[model samples]
Target: MAGWAAAAALLLLPLFAVQFTDGVNWEMVDFSVFGAMLLGAGVSYELAVRMTGSSAYRAAVGVAVAAAFLLVWINLAVGIIGSEDNSANLMYGGVLAIAVIGAAIGRFQSAGMTRALSATALAQVLVGIIALAAEFGSTAPSFPEAIVLSTGFFVALWLLSAYLFLKAASG
Candidate 1:
C-alpha cells in the first residue's frame, strides 16, 4: 500500500510541476511511460521481497530497482550522451539488458544477484569507455563530462547493489 501511494505521489508530482513552470511540461505519453516504469519497479521489488527473508537482500533489490528506474528516466528525459534524439543514448539500453539477462541467469538468488550486478557495473564502465573513444554523442549537451559523470554514478549504484547482495549471501 505504501509503494502504491508513493507511486501515485510521484506520478502527480509532474502534474504539479507543469502547472508551476514551462520547464516541467509532460504529455500523456510521458505520464504513461513513467507510470509503467514505476509500476514495474514496484512490482519487481515486491516480488523480490517475497523471495528473500534477508534485510540485505531487500536492500539490494531496492538499489537495483532504483538504479534501473533512474537510468530509464534520465535516458528518456534527456539523452544521457546527448539529446534524447541522439542514437548514442541507445547504448545505455545495453547496460539494462545486461542486468536483466544476468538476473534471469542468476535465478534471483543472492549469490547470483551479486555476480549479475557486478557484471552490470562492468558493462556500464565498458559502455562509457566505448562512448568516449567513439565520440558517440559529441554534439549533445554536456557531452563528455556529463557522460563520464553519469557513467560513474550508475557504476557505483550497480556496485553497491552487488555488494549488498554479496553480504546477504554471506550472512
Candidate 2:
C-alpha cells in the first residue's frame, strides 16, 4: 500500500513538473504509458514482497524488480545508448523475453528465476557490446561513449540480481 502510494506520488511528479515548467513536455500518451508502468512496478513489487518470507530475499527481489522496471521504462522513454530509434535498443526485449520464457518453463522456482536472471544479465552485456559496435561503426562515436559503460552498469545490476536470486534459492 505504501509502495503504491509512493508510486502514485512519483508518477504525479512529472505531471506537476509539466505544469510548473516548460522543460517537462509530456503528452497524454506518455502519462498513460508511464502511469501503467509505475502501477505495474508497484503491484509486482508488492506481490514479490508478499510472496517472499526472508527480509534479505525481499530486499534483493525489490532491487531486481526496480532495476528491471527502470530498464524498460528508460528504454521506452529514451534510448539507453542513444535515441529510442536505435536498433541496439531492441536488445532490451531480449532480456524480458528470456526471463519470461525461463520463468514459464521453470515455473518461476528459485533455479528458474536464477537462470532467468543470469540470462537477462548476459543479454544486458550483449546489448552493450552491440551498442559499442554500432557506435564505432558509425562515422564517429559521440560523447558519453554510448553502450559500453551504460550497458556495463545494467549488466552489473542484472548480475547482482542473479546473485540475489541464487542466494534466495540456496537459503
Candidate 3:
C-alpha cells in the first residue's frame, strides 16, 4: 500500500509540475511509461523483500532496480549515444537483457545475483567501449567523455549491487 501510494505521489509530481511550468510538459505517453516503470520497480523490490530476510540482499535488489530504471529512463529521455532517436541507443537493451537473463538463471539467489551484477557491470563497460570505438556519439561535443562518464556511473552502481549481494551470500 505504501509503495503504491508512493508511486501515485511520484506520478502526481509531474502532473503538478506541468501546471506550474512549461518546462514540465509531459504527454499521456510519458506518464504511462513512467508509471509502468515505477510499478515494475516496486513489484521487483516487493518480490525481493518477500524472498529474503537479509538486508544486504534487499539493498542489492534496490540498487539493481534503480540502475535498470535509470538506464531506461535516461535512454528514452535523451539517448545515451546521441539524441533520443539514435539507433545506437538500442545496444543498451542488450545490457538490460543480460541482467534479466542472469537474474532468472540465478533464481535471485545472493551468490547468483552477485555474478549477475558483476557481469552487468562488465557488459556496461563493454558497451561504452564499443560505442566509443564505433563513434556512436562522435558528432556530439561531449563524445567519448560523456560515454565514459555515464558508463562509469552505471558500472559503479552495478558493482555496488554485486558487492552487497556478495556480502549477503557470505553472511
Candidate 4:
C-alpha cells in the first residue's frame, strides 16, 4: 500500500508541476475522476493480492503495466514514437494489450485475481475515455491544462500498479 502510494505521488508530480507552473485551476470533476481511478486501482490490487496469495504474480503484473505505460509515455515525451497522427490510438491499443495479457496470465494462474485485475483494467479504459472527452469538450483546454489532466490519470494508474507490485513483494 505504501509503495503504491509512493508511486502515485511520484506520478502526480509532473501534473502538479504543470498545474502550478501554468496556473491552471483543476475542476471538481477532474479531481473526482482521478480520485475514483486511484481508489479503484487500490481496491482491485488489494483484492487480487488477497485472492492469489502469490506476491510474485502481483508484482509481475504491476511492473509489467507500469513499465509498459512508462515506456510509451517516454516515447511520446521524447518524440521517439508518437507523432500527431494516431498517437491516441496507439497508446490506447498498447494499454489494452497490456491489460489483456495481464488478464490472460491471471486466468492461467488465478481466475479470481485475473478477474479483479481485468475489472480494474476495464475501469481504466473507461476513465481514459472520460478523460479524453473532458479534454476535447466544448472548451478545449490549454496545453498546460491538458498536460496536468493527463498526468493525473497516469498517476492514478501508476498507483494501482504500484499496489500490485508491493503486494507481490510482500507476499
| TM-score of every candidate | 0.97, 0.88, 0.95, 0.40
User: How well is each residue in 1-171 modelled by candidate 2, as lDDT tens digits?
Assistant: 677788889889999999999988999999999888888877777777778786656766676677778788877876676777666677788877886687678675666777887888888777677667656324334424656666777777777877787888888
The per-prediction CA RMSD against the true structure, in angstroms, equals: 0.9, 2.2, 1.2, 10.6
Top-scoring candidate (TM-score):
1
Candidate 3 local lDDT, 1-171, one digit each (tens) = 987898899999999999999888899999999999999999999999999999999999999999999999999988889777889989899999999999989988999999999999999999999999999988888787889999999999999999999999999
Kindly list the per-residue Cα lDDT of model 1 for residues 25-130, writing each as its tens digit. 7999999999999999999999988887999999999999999999999989987887888777788899999999999999998999999999999999998998
The TM-score measured for candidate 2 stands at 0.88
- Residue 101, candidate 1: Cα error in Å is 0.8
* Worst ten in a row by lDDT for model 4: 77-86
Full-model lDDT for every candidate:
0.93, 0.75, 0.93, 0.51
Off by over 4 Å in 3: none
When sorted by lDDT, best at the front, the candidate numbers are 3, 1, 2, 4
> After superposition, which runs of candidate 4 have C-alpha atoms over 4 Å from their true positions?
11-15, 23-40, 68-80, 84-95, 98-171
